[model samples]
Target: MGAFGRNHARVYQQLQQAGSVRLVGVVDPDTARADAIAREFGCKSFGSVEQMLTTHSEVQAASVAVPTVLHREVARALMEAGVDVLIEKPVAATLGEADELLRVALEHKRVAQVGHLERFNPAVRATLPLINRPMFFEVHRLSVFSPRALDVDVVLDLMIHDLDVVLTFVKSEVKEIRAVGLPILSGKVDIANVRIEFESGCVANFTASRVSTERVRKLRFFQAGQYISVDYARQDVLVCSVGSAVGAAHSFATDANEWGTRPSVNPQIQMAKPPITAEEPLLAEIKAFLRSVRDRSRPAVSLEDGRKALELGLAILAEIGRHAGRIAVGKG
Candidate 1:
């Protein structure tokens, strides 16, 4: 386990303490790193997946936090051994690899889940009830420059999270994609801006960057008679609604100061804050994976979902290339 892998180990330890699941062991090619994390988390360490499974045949479930390129190999080994797995984000390095992963899971009948962490964010979970036929969206995910996650560009590394969420919320085919991206600090794209149009006549704008001066993660959407704002880092959702409250599904709390009495045509704009119980998203994701493994149920974010998001991400990268070609022609 590296940095993110260590975080996964930590969450699993916490989960075991809560009596949700058992922390079996951590595996990594680096024996030094694996042994160190195992000691720190009070779990066994193995230099390879084969050794781990050999020593602990009871590992019913595992989180494949290995590199994207190695996801297919590691997860296939786990599933081939009768173990379910939770593959980390960007499922694989390519669509073909993702398809192979799907095939392996199907053949083994394993409970496969994708680690789309944002799907388990408290704010996102809270915003589920506020969903309507969302017509428009504005999403921003920025981070101060860091060396982590540089294996893939900002699109696959960061924007894929929002892509997964939006694809789920929209539940429609992607109609068009327009994107522009360029690398700054890393050889891969470190900043990107994209617009995705859905078949349902919905549009979303996404900005993702890893070379920012500050950190921000927010998603806002507009639907009929409502505007929703979600702060992912803060784990908060704010719903501001206008128009008559007739036949509204969610009752609005009346407080003059909540939205501040507006003058003129805008009579009343009801604002509501949904209650959210905060928990580490990794813990939630792991617990959900274990539950699915135990009950023979589908995961919250299935492999199909991961494939769809990866397809969209690859599409975005393609569009970025097309746009860059046009710009280069002009400069030439």
Candidate 2:
């Protein structure tokens, strides 16, 4: 759909190897990129989405990897043309645009998947087993400064990944939110922090930075008697939980009349073993989309999921603006 169209082509080719789907065509406003991808993937290339859909009747689905601003238009066009779509995340630049795209998908009765590839990550899947009634969560996603994603702030660019994960674990509506952001490198906010309180009484603290000196992607979850940590980049999960023997030990001490004789000993902690790593998440995501298309099933990340992440990202941006205004007023 745009500059990152090449990645979509590559991932789709991998999915084809996995015996799911094949790439039938490529579309980009830039002829050079479009032609290059077409040659590499052995598919037809078109200068625009309209031309591609009009000329190709065999294409049953599309991966709309366009810019945030053009997401709605390209996705709506594909859905309106009766082609299922896998739209890259943040869905669209605005919630209204995302809503319209969803409406179009419903009108056409086609699948509209969102590209939240983290959902397919092996480490995230490993951590999923440990997520039970999380009381608190902390996430940090930092990346070395990149000029490629200057169109959006850090909240949309990075924080949304953790936000989706948090929302998945909490399984509740957000009751309150507070955020702050500033532009240290890019003109738009390059670093941001957000605190979200869910109706289930789970609190999440998230931080994202696109102007960092180093890159790190990690999340930690705290529950009643356990802690879970996930390292997305390294594909690792660490769990620390209190052992069941602790309660038995306490009961024995009480029977011995040692209730107040000594301070309560800490519960023994246990760690779970790591899980096997899987294929690339982007490739898995593409395969999932193709399977959904063929079986007429829902996607792993649906249009509504993308819309909720976008809404949360936009709300964080609004909160940042308000915080910045307060800071400016205080300085003046």
What TM-score, over all chains together, does every model reach? 0.93, 0.92
lDDT of each: 0.90, 0.84
Evaluated with lDDT, which candidate comes out highest? 1
Tens-digit lDDT string for candidate 2 (230-285):
88888888888778766444332325477656455787888886665666888778
Deviation of model 2 at 232, angstroms: 0.8
Error of 2 at 73 (Å): 0.3
Which residue segments of model 1 deviate by more than 4 Å?
245-264
